[model samples]
Target: MMWKIQLFKLNFDHRERDAVLETVDSGWLTMGERILGFEAAFGDYLGHGARCTAVSNGTAALHMALLALDVGQGDEVIIPALTFVADANAVRMVGARPVLADCASRSDWNVSAESIARKITPRTKAVIVVHYAGFPCDMPAIAALCRERGLKLVEDVAHAPGASIAGQMCGTFGDVGCFSFFSNKNLSIGEGGMVVACDGNLSQRLRYLRSHGMTTLTLDRHKGRAATYDVAEPGLNYRMDEIRAAIGLVQLDKLPAGNLRRKELTERYRRNLAGSPLQMPFDNLSADVVSAYHILPVLLPQACDRMGVIEMLKTAGVQSSIHYLPFSGFTAYREYFTAQDAPLAEEICSRELTMPLYPTMSDREVDLVTGALLGAVA
Candidate 1:
């Protein structure tokens, strides 16, 4: 059913269309100069000598990062249970066990250092931290713990691209920073992803692994820069196409302004929802952090019916979504972890409701959704 307000809308324009059309016209649709330009531009945006390898999607980025780090059989990767299932699946794909961590609370949906510490064991090779809903995780504390325990840190930065914590970018603080450019993300490009690594060697490995372990890209061969290429090792066809890369370059340019707009909308939600029954989530961002403002999820009161609220909103011409169901709560992952493993995650998952938030949403739309929510609960 269509609603007056949508959960999200793509912030595309003729520019994205022109970029894709131009790529098609060039007859270079695979990994090419556009991908390289996107990577270089993203690297500069990431700063701190961060290098990016454009991939097919966010899941590919995470998988490549894990493979590049040699996280394999018998090893365990700890990740928060509150994020999308891809994080846990990536660990499993690498032949590693995923030890689920819990989010702090409904008010703060990110995994705390304490949660990570509890899940860490001798087999824990790394920790994958998701910057849930664009809120930066406590990277400094988590990094310190990883250092103390000699564990690698991988950042699942799908929700955060320009987001910063303590003046440092979210993707740059960890060993490997994986990003997604899904249709609804802050940096949407239809379907694309990137992996950033501070270590040059690791970054090189990621680049090689992104395109089937080829010693050289097809672009090099096409340009006559290389006579032939060799397959160094097994890799996947995870390379980002030229059209998506072109679109990503455009989206990347708009991210800062878009995030500013989201911030304004989020503040409006905070003000409009004040004294209302719904509980707001993740309003405790430190002064030093700049969130991507990817989503606005409020926790419904326990006394209220979650589905009833969503249906009410729909009847009132508003749309809503759930950020996620705890990964451990899913059938595929249940055997690997139990509901009791992350109590807070399970609690938040049941109540969390994502309100419509996007760069193109109008003030009137925001007001409509908020007013509908208020009347629904009332």
Candidate 2:
């Protein structure tokens, strides 16, 4: 269906088109120099000598991270109950159990060190913290806790790319940081992701894992860099294509300015909905924290007619969505279906509503969305 104000609009320009066209004309598609270039540019942006490996998508990044970290059968990985399903899905893929950790509270919306500690056990191998709605989690405390317990930390940075805390990039804070370049993310590239590690060994393992565990790349063989190769271990075809990599480079250049615009727009939405029934989550962040402002998610009042509000939004040509439903409540996770462990998460998930938020979205659109929501609630 068409929308006068859809969920998100691409921040594309002639540069993206030109990049795509040039990459197509070069005829060296499929994880070639463009992928390397994208990786290098991204690593430079990440800084602190981060070893960046671009992957097929966000899920692939998550899978590769878990695999590289050796989080497999009989191990338990702690994940936020309120995050996207991909986290639990990735953990499940590796034959590990997903221990659902409740959100910090109605305001933070992210899994905190306290919540994570409560869920830890003898089998717990890793803890994956999602910076929900692109707000930085209390990473310093989380990192300290992980270090104390000898557990691995993986960051689901799909919602946060340029976000940082304590002068360190979000992805760099953990052992393995995974970023998504999905169409709706802060860095929009349609279908791509990056996995970064501060450890050289882990980075090398991730690099090999992304390309079917081969010792050498096809691009290297094509360029006669290596005459023979060996399969170090079995891996997947999670290599990103050239087109998306080229597009990602362009997106990277535009990220900072775009994030600032999103920050401005986020404040606009807050002002517009000041007296509305909906309550915004993830506020009162640290002064050192820098958010990418990837998406805008607000909480509707309990017992309110959320579905009716959504339908009313549709009539006004506005589109909205739920950021997520708790993974525990899904049929796929029946064994782990108890919400008792993550009552806060279940409570927040029930009322969480994701409104339209994108860099290109205008103040007028923000007002329109808020106005429609207010009318629907009233």
lDDT of 2: 0.92
RMSD of 1: 1.0
Model 1 C-alpha lDDT per residue in residues 218-249, reported as the tens digit of each score: 88999999999898888888988899999999
Give the alpha carbon lDDT tens digit for every residue of 1-378 in model 2.
Answer: 899999899999999999999999998888899999999999999998898999989999999999999999999999999899999999999999999998888888899999999999999999999998899899999999999999999999999888998788899989999999998898999999999999999999998899888998889899999998999988888999999999999999999999999999999988988877888886677789999898889898889877998999999999999988877668999787687878988888888788999988989989999999888888
Model 2 spans with C-alpha error above 4 angstroms: none
Badly placed stretches (over 4 Å) of model 1 are none
Residue pairs in steric clash, candidate 1?
A: none
Error of 2 at 186 (Å): 1.1
The alpha-carbon RMSD values of the candidates against the true structure, listed in the order shown, are 1.0, 0.9
